[model samples]
Target chain A: MTDFKVKGKVWLITDNNGELINDIDTDQIFHNQFLHITEISEMGEHTFGNLEGWENFPEKCNPGDIVFAGSNFGAGSSRQQAVDCFEALGIKAIVAESYGAIYKRNAINSGFPILIFQQINNFVKDDAIKNLDEIEIDFLAGELKNISSGKIFKINPFSKVQKDIMEKGSLLTI
Target chain B: MPGKTVIEKIFTNHSKEDISPGKIVWIDLDVVTARDFGGPNVVKNFHKNYEGQSVFDQSKVFFTFDLTVPPKTIQYANNQMICRKFAKEKGVKVFDIDKGIGTHTLIENGLVPSGSIVVGTDSHMNILGAVNSFGQGMGDVDIAFGFRYGRTWFEVPETVKVKIKGNSSYDYSAKDLVIKALSILRTDKILGKAVEFYGDPIEKLDLPERITFLSMITEMGGIVGFIPFNNNTENEIKKMSGLDNIVPEIKADGDASYSEIIDLDISDIESMVSAPPYPHNGMKVSDLEKVNVDFGFVGSCTNGRIEDILKVWTILKGKKIKEGVQLSIVPATIEVYKQAFEKGILKDLLDAGAIIANPGCGGCAQGHIGMTGKGEVMVSTGNRNFPGKQGDGFNYLTSPEVVAFSVLNGFISDREF
Candidate 1:
């Protein structure tokens, strides 16, 4: 197994109080209104369009940025657009407390990175990212380190299949 | 050896090995399904990945033109065309245009059987567990792979054994029972879990009633819901499929281990509703009487069966909808529509001023017809009530009877037996 490393700006997905939002369904991640938009390149602008705090994510987001979310990150509806939007927005990886079963599979098959870490929401909630200059993630090592805060959070290791898919591009390719 | 849950037995049966929760198995699929929105995506993946590869078994693939049936827009039409072309080229049966929904069409045509491991590209495939089959939703990419390889991977989920007692009245439907289950289980509690319904309460429900009950299991965060195999279940399967006899029943061991046991009573569940924003926000209908309903919908894969529509037709036989209230009746598939139409049930609904829609997943996912405008509130029989799910409006989930009564009263109203 190889440890995948990524360093990127941290994007916190939370409410105004900075508490992580739970049960973020796929429609909230990417509204069904844009289902007509087939081209993924045009999907970034609609990412989080229905979500309150992240409506302007298209212009505000940068490629390779990491997103932090609460439990059931991609719950409800098996629309691939939810994970596809993140990939379109160039999201390097999504570290949530948990994910919907279908979303987890869609992410893995698409070779999108999704990591799980209990208490990840606590670290990202309530201005936890204010002091962090950069977030570094080591998939195999199961360590999430904040450069500025010098804080290290332990993430759960991925299953063999998950790690293999992420490395092999997609399940089809594998 | 100890007994196994229905899901465990399924995995073991397919792999010919002992299987348990937390185990990953590459089980061969008994049936693979895809609908309009997901079908186009699967077609895209099929072409991209398996250009020269022949389908594993074309007859095993099921494609239905739902979500955008009748072609709501040009893009949707093109997508449906893609699915149609794929089905034609691969010799897969396509339930093209107004076939109701995929699962309904599949079931109504008798394509599925007990003990089968069914997977679809849409999440609502969990509804198939009503017949003791293990039905789960997969993404388009995985479904495409299943079409090529006739196998897909699954991490066997833990079993949540639910035992139900008490008999339900006419007004208090299986929909209420499911909504009550959602209230108790919550959306995240049953994640990646297979829910097995047991006891007399489950045994009493008919096939249509069972479909309506298990259809919303996904909304409760469950991967699938089962009512085990019984003679009644087999008879219902036979009636729908026109099959004289099914292979055999697949029953769990008497000592099957369950991760959790929930005791639910059917008599205790009233006409419950899931308020706006989430399906878990369930409350009894009497508490929501103050909320005026602008529209009412009585169809979807969840509640669009013949029995559900007949219930609505029974109530609205000699009545008209309240002034200014719009009620739309959507059947699950062409067969359901034809049955209802032949029996004059559709006429009764139409006479009651209901706007009968084409057989499809209209308004269930916020597209096609029956969408609500800003600030509009609708009492619908569809699954899920997420914001912007059916346009900028508030949605309350309920049974067909409550929807009919709400249409007559122009507000969320409870029904009497």
Candidate 2:
């Protein structure tokens, strides 16, 4: 089984005004022009290619980085490239207020970690979280520790099937 | 007895253990499918894990090609060739370019049974919910797993009950009703939940109209939208399948618990239009400033059925599209195309100076013919108005009546109620 505890740098998917971005659909995360590329390794460079102010996210992100977004993180189409592109960049996890229903299924079945943070509005209000901050997450414990801000918060933990799928890395393996 | 929503009842019929929201359960799948866009990836993953193996049941699986059906580029052709080879070698069926959108093919051809589960690669597969079925879209590997095992895991979703009351006095279509729902509910009101539509207005909708309303649930973030099966639903099923009892007599109990119950009144609803950046960003048609539309399209799984085509024909019958305005019409399936041709609907549209494309999803993607240029405005009947969906142009989503009137005027306009 993989590590239940993960520590990585957090990159906030926000607007120029520093507010959390909501409804960042699949098209913005990975544009339709790159749907032809089947190989996961080649998907990293095109992450956020269609979104303004974040087109160079692939070049700026580091391995084992974590991401934070607002409601409906993957709102549009069920193209797996939206989730696969982040895996190609070695993202540890994605924390959002909520997600599109099918997008959550696609992420869970692929063994990618997408956690729910319901109180993210409070974090946004206080400006408690910043980009490139260090954070630690425990999947089973439902805990989040923001080392940069010296704060700890409770999160929604994994479901029975999600925990099982992550251990095997995908539904096919399990 | 206590109450259960349509989703709970459907899962109870297919699953082993007790069912509830947030409880993960493995359920039997009645139908499994993939299309050209993601079919090849699913095939590759299937072989990688279950090498030299046959699918769980060949009859349950199919490949439908609607996206770039004619193979616009060499890469696309190569991808389709892989699916064709795999389907042939595995003795699986293929609804090739001759067919229309895979989702429509399944419903119109009666491949999907009501009150059952179906999985596919297209996100809009939730359209099956129009017929009281539980349909969902998943990734390549997940679908691959379904192909091998014929079962998949699903967490029962909490349902929201929407009671639609008050028939509008204005002569409106399903498009107007759905637009009114979006404007009232916005995007996230029903996120991660199921919507059970209940009311007299809902029961009166025809099969095509029911599909048109439920197809937009994807934009609302609902997993699926269910309308209790009525006499019309059963009649349509019987006609399509040519069999009796295709639609099961199942429904949510009267006392079912819903996360939220909303009463949507449509008595005074007005004609609506959605502008670019998001399809739910709607405004009254009369309030929108007139914008020149160089490109126009009327076809997609959302509203490309026979009824929608008939609406366009009635409007454009002896009238020509304005000069310099290029309008394209595509039927959703071959059956629809054949019917239109036999009834002389295609001739009337052609006489109105409209270009009639084959029955497939030609105008919905960049690989198709309807992509627009920078600063150009396009008024379409497709479900989405997301950027880059039809290329660099600004996209506006509206009803066929609105589109027909807009194209005739060479600008954004709506038909009188």
Candidate 3:
């Protein structure tokens, strides 16, 4: 079990189909500890497999790194398994414009952090950007700062308890 | 401050001092329930973290294994085993195996007291409020905490008083009333709020009918929907529980504060329908033109009571369901199923071409039998009609009468008394 830290170049995905299947390369974000995005798709076996692809994409990826995706991500299935699989893969937080209600609750209850951001799809580049550098998350301030690119993004702040759970690790620990 | 509805009175009376919505109240938990699906995780977490002896009063804690029993997966089986072990080790006496009913139903028929605050690990636990209890669904962590400490915090909710007045024809029932309410409130209006049903008409409903009404509060995003305990409630408790001394704390003085109130006259209510994709998209039965249904179901925690079964039976007594429409019925509990069997309601439904299944929430969640096909339209009495909820198809919600009549006429029909 490795602790996750965001300390590499950023790679943002802007595909409407935010699936990390063979077509989309997560190598940049996974290898460099960067952020990525794509549109939400229906949750299915194929999608579950694609999520597992994160294992090969990131170098030292662990649960706790933030993922910035597009609107309506995680929009299907009341099954907690989908969210659990992501947690198992070491993706700590998911920042999207919107989420399906059931998925949001499941993510929260499972101790995964989710943040909603507006125009997030347009803020980062679609392709991999080297030297994108480390991003600092000031959870209380609800601000994300990119050290290399000198870019900053605003994220919706979570409640104090929610922040504690995210920072201290899973609800199992809390 | 006077002349408040019964629900309003009770909520205000029991509310923690200076507490309001969006803020945690930290009130005493009168009851805490858990089941197989999430119960093991909660107990495991509790044992691992808390070294205290029993936190809450043992008499107030309830546990059951309904959802994951006959375990759906190996993981589910393992979880149930852990839960059973924990329950035994913790000295919790209410653990029931195959004979156990669903948690909400069990609580209703067992130990839940009126005017008490209740929390459960399952989302549908809110359904327990039909007996005038205030219930809410909490995450596993909160539930574990409650297990470790007899009390938990809450953000006292503003009350939404719904007064249902007037008598309804045989075709309309409380299920229709709630379906209409859900259609009007959508899914967001009642989030984290309490809905109280009152009026002389509401008093006339039986326990099962009232349970059907209260069970759908979650559909409107409410924490719970309740009615003040009355003689009817006491009598039902006596009959079901065989306990004569269970007196419920009904409500507080009438002069209480309420956030909002809505009056509904059911005398003029006709058979109603909630179309696919949303429960709030409601229309009159007469307005359902060009809408064809391939499947029809009359069961769920919301509409699976004996009274609901009788209503469906009354509609299908001398009629047969339309050709090409697959109809199914599932009673909510074993006791209800036995009651229907003894009363010949199940035979009537079965003889009329309806498939009878065991008493549980099966097809309602689209997990078990009666899954709809692509583009198939189903008329159901279950709560919630979100897209692909009853399978990858369209589902419309309505009263049991409407479901029965639609099964008979091959299309949505107004229930004839």
Candidate 4:
């Protein structure tokens, strides 16, 4: 398999202080009250509707933008809508300090990308993000680079199974 | 080498491969479940992606219409029809309109026997851990794969051991015990890990209480909660699931390695309630006696069993809910509903001005019938108190006894009687 790099403009799923919020549950990602709308293509319009600071995310975000988050992102409920919303928006990847177990699997199985970098919080702390324009992730090189700051951080490589799943584009494909 | 926990053992046995925490392994699923919201999506993917391939085993795959039973709208009705059409064509087990909550329906019909490794599209599928099954929630896409090929991959979870060591003479319910446990462990501590509850107090709990305990672990961000299978659990499983001669028990070794071991004394616990906004935001009920409540709810998969209802009736019988409080009671399943009705539990609740909703997810799923209004304060027996979990209101998580008392008094109660 070839090395995969996710390079895109960064979007913060954070609080007012710019600290990445912990436990951003699925209900906040995509509210369950709108679950009756079954079509994934139409889901992007309502992404982050219930969550504060990101209610207008669909209007602000561009396709291929990468989302940065804190610990336990997508924590509650197993609504694939949480993932499908991102897929519908064409979000390139999600880089989080941690994730809910089911969301990790769902993202991978849906052929979406989510990476774990433990030190991500250090780089995106309160107001440090205003200077950041873009980020680049090279899994094979095991590094994340800030385009504006030119500061690079190391990330753990995927396990054999994860690498295989990413290569195959989905778990079912593997 | 240390002996494996029940989760590890199940994975090892099913995959026919050595498995450890953090290592991903593939295993054929014994059962797969999807509720109303995810069922239609699974059906769509199976048809559009799999080229109309048949499921691995029709009987093992099932869908239940719990979230929007009886179809509250055209969209929901259409979703149910899509799932129903798929089930009809594929010959799979499909429980529709008023079959009860999905997990309760499965348990009531003897589908989830001991020693089974199960997966469902809904997060609360972890409730099956009470039956000693290796049950975990997964995304509907993975469940779709399980439906198509009967196999899925999982990373073996690290185990957290909890041992209960005391008895309670107070009006404490299993909900209180789990809320207190969540308060101690917190959500981050147990995220993605399997929690195994054991010891004398666990052994003393009946089937309903055991299920109640397992159901609340989801609120802690845990993957699954387990009570080791013993003769008592086996007998209860036989009695409730109607499966006699259960398989031999699966237990952790005496030297089983756990990431953390929590020792809890039930007698040290008082009636606990979770404050608004989070399930782990717990405090002693006595500390919040001045808080007024506008609504009271006494049902959900978490605490809607016969035993839980009895806990409420023990206090609320021959008493009226406060004039200003609106109380709703929903039993978990049709069988539980029937049992409650036969025992006159439903009559007692209705006579006390409780509005009994249909036997489904109801208020627990949120936005269903009988929702709490914005700025309204509710004391609920449901598992979660997350914002909008039961509508635009402030929710307090507590035992049914407390919920019953709060309804009668129109405030968060401190008194046992």
Return the lDDT, model 1, position A94. Answer: 90
Candidates 1 onward: DockQ, in order: 0.64, 0.72, 0.10, 0.66
Cα error, candidate 4, residue B366 (Å): 3.6
Candidate rank order under DockQ: 2, 4, 1, 3
Model 2: pairs clashing at backbone N, Cα or C within 3 Å: none
Q: Summarize candidate 2's per-residue lDDT along A1-174 as a digit string, tens digits.
A: 488889999999888778778888788888877776778899999999987789999999999999999988888787888889999999989999999887898899899999999878679668777788899999999999999989999999987888999999899999
lDDT of every predicted structure (CA atoms): 0.82, 0.85, 0.62, 0.82
Per-residue lDDT tens digits for candidate 4, residues B1-417, read 778888888788789768888788888799898888888888877886786689889889998889877788899999989888988888997888788888878888888877788888778888888888877777778888899999888878999998877766765667888888888777788888998888866666778888888887887888888886655767788888887767777777788789898886667678899997888899998776588889998888889888888878888788898998898888888888888889987778878888988888886775575778889999998887777778788999888889988888888995644
> How much of the true contact map at the interface does candidate 4 reproduce, as a fraction?
0.57
Q: What digit string (tens of lDDT, one per residue) describes model 1 on residues A90-174?
A: 9898988888888888888887889998886666654455422588988878888888688887888777778877787777777
In order, what is each prediction's RMSD in angstroms? Answer: 2.1, 1.7, 7.9, 2.0
Higher-scoring candidate on lDDT, 1 or 2:
2
What is the per-residue lDDT of model 2 for residues B1-417, given as tens digits with 9 covering 90 to 100? Answer: 468999999999899978888788899998898887778888888888999998889999999898886888887888889889988888889999989988889877777777878999878888888877888887787889999999999888999999999866777778878887877777788888889988987877888888888888888888899887766678886775555667565688878889899998878777777788787787778888778889889988888987898998899999988899988888899988888888888888998989888888887855386678887888888888877778788999888888898899888887622
lDDT of predicted model 4 = 0.82
Q: Model 3 — TM-score against the truth?
A: 0.74
Q: After superposition, which runs of candidate 2 have C-alpha atoms over 4 Å from their true positions?
A: none
- Best prediction by lDDT: 2
Candidate 3 stretches with Cα past 4 Å from truth are: A1-86, A89-91, A94-111, A114-137, A142-156, A163-174, B1-18, B43-58, B72-76, B93-97, B161-171, B197-204, B228-234, B237-243, B246-269, B415-417
- TM-score of model 4's chain A: 0.90
**Worst lDDT window (10 residues) for model 2 chain A?**
A121-130
TM-scores of the candidates in the order shown: 0.95, 0.97, 0.74, 0.96
Q: Taking the tens digit of each residue's C-alpha lDDT, what string does model 4 give over A60-172?
A: 99998888888888887888889999989989888888888888888878777788888677767734443236888886666788886787788765656667777887766
Error of 1 at B171 (Å): 5.0
Model 4 stretches with alpha carbons more than 4 Å out: A1-3, A126-132, B165-169, B229-231, B264-267, B414-417
